[model samples]
Target: MRKFLLPLLFILLFIAESLFVQFLPGDFFGGNRILAPRFLFSALLLLTIFVGRKKGIIYAAIFGLIFDIVYIEIIGIYLFLFPFVAYVISKIMHVLQANIIVAYFVSILGIALLEIGVYEMDYLIHVTNLDFLDFLNLRLYPTLILNAAFLLIFIYPLKRYFEKYAEALRDE
Candidate 1:
């Protein structure tokens, strides 16, 4: 039951991404800004910090593959990116304190990494026509804002949950 909660929460976040886009007002000033939900990646970063890198990477791989299969035609993009981001966050956690304030910034870092990695990959494959400046203006800003809000709202509960879960696992 405890184990299932983590994956179930991720599944909810994954589904919520599309729902978020659907509910947001369709048009914005400044030529229709884009807000891609990277909430799961934020959770993954929290998972790495409060849980452990091993569990974090495992969940990342599972959820990443699901994300690719359901949300993308490209099969390997998130499949590769998720665990990669989690690994990087694990290393970063070694250098920085994992308190709420720093963790919030770290969540932002995770979102930024995921966003830039996607932009770069898409640019390389010619999937996106938006240039660097357009990417910054249209996608990065909105996406960061959206995911930042998510982290702000959920960070404490998530941190506490992960810490409790980790403690339980250690006891077993």
Candidate 2:
């Protein structure tokens, strides 16, 4: 029940973030860009790592699948990429201490880089012959900053809630 609840709650939050991103006006914050859904994904990925690798992978895959379905992108890209990110993060979890804030920051930064790289590579290989700098300045930077800021603000409480929830699960 505990295992199920954590993931379920995470999924609910993910869906909420996705809907918000989809419906909200991008110009709400003085025209600065934001990838609201990606921030949730980063937080979810980091939390999953702290919980355990297998559990984290499961959460990432689920979130990625939902993200893929909703967003106007290649269908399987996020589903494939996000779980792989979680898996890599999980492998290195032992080397890092159990500091939630640090993990959130690191994860957000990594995700930002990953998102940019993936976008560039996809464009280069399949989408267009566009200038790389244009993409970076126009799209990637804004999304990265927004996602990272969201992670910084939300990581602590979400981590604490998940920790307590996991502990309760264990006690059962």
Candidate 3:
């Protein structure tokens, strides 16, 4: 139960966030120049780190798959990329523990770059026609910034929650 609960909770959070993106008022507040979905990806990356590499990879893939399904994008792009990013972050988790703020910022930045790279690759290969720079400026950057800001507010709580849960599992 302990092993499953956290990932389940993360999934719920992902669903809620997706709903907010789809139906919330002011989702793209002040036009599309202000926020993007990059934060969601970043948050997932952070959560995965706390959860451990294998679990993190699983969650990232699940999140990406769900995101891809809901957003009408290519089926496996996020599924492939998100987990890959999580795996990369997991490898660096040790280094990141020195300073979480720096870790989070760097993780988010990496996620942003990964996102852009995937999109660019698709576009270049004619799988997509998205205007790379416009998409980054108008959507990706804003979303990433919002997500990073959210991390600033919630990282400690999330870390504590995971630690307590992991401790409980150990006691079991």
TM-score leaderboard ranking: 1, 2, 3
The candidate maximizing lDDT is 1
lDDT by residue for model 3 (1-172), tens: 6678776767767776767666755734665474544545665666666656776687688877987897745788777888888877777776767246766766776667676767676877798666867877876777677777777887777767766775775698
For each candidate in turn, give its C-alpha RMSD to the true structure in angstroms: 1.2, 2.7, 2.9
Per-residue accuracy of model 1 over 1-172 as CA lDDT, tens digit each: 7878988998888878878878877675345888888877888889988888999999999888998998888999998998999899889989988899998998798888888998999999999989999899899998898888889899999999988999999999
Q: What's model 2's overall lDDT?
A: 0.70
Clashes of each: 0, 0, 4
lDDT value, residue 86 of candidate 3: 81
- TM-score of each candidate structure, all chains considered together: 0.95, 0.80, 0.78
lDDT: which is higher, 1 or 2? 1
Angstrom error of the Cα, residue 74, model 1: value is: 1.1
lDDT values, one for every candidate: 0.87, 0.70, 0.70
Number of the predicted model whose TM-score against the real structure is largest = 1
**lDDT tens string, model 2, 9-43?**
77677776767777889887657554545755676
Error of 3 at 125 (Å): 4.8
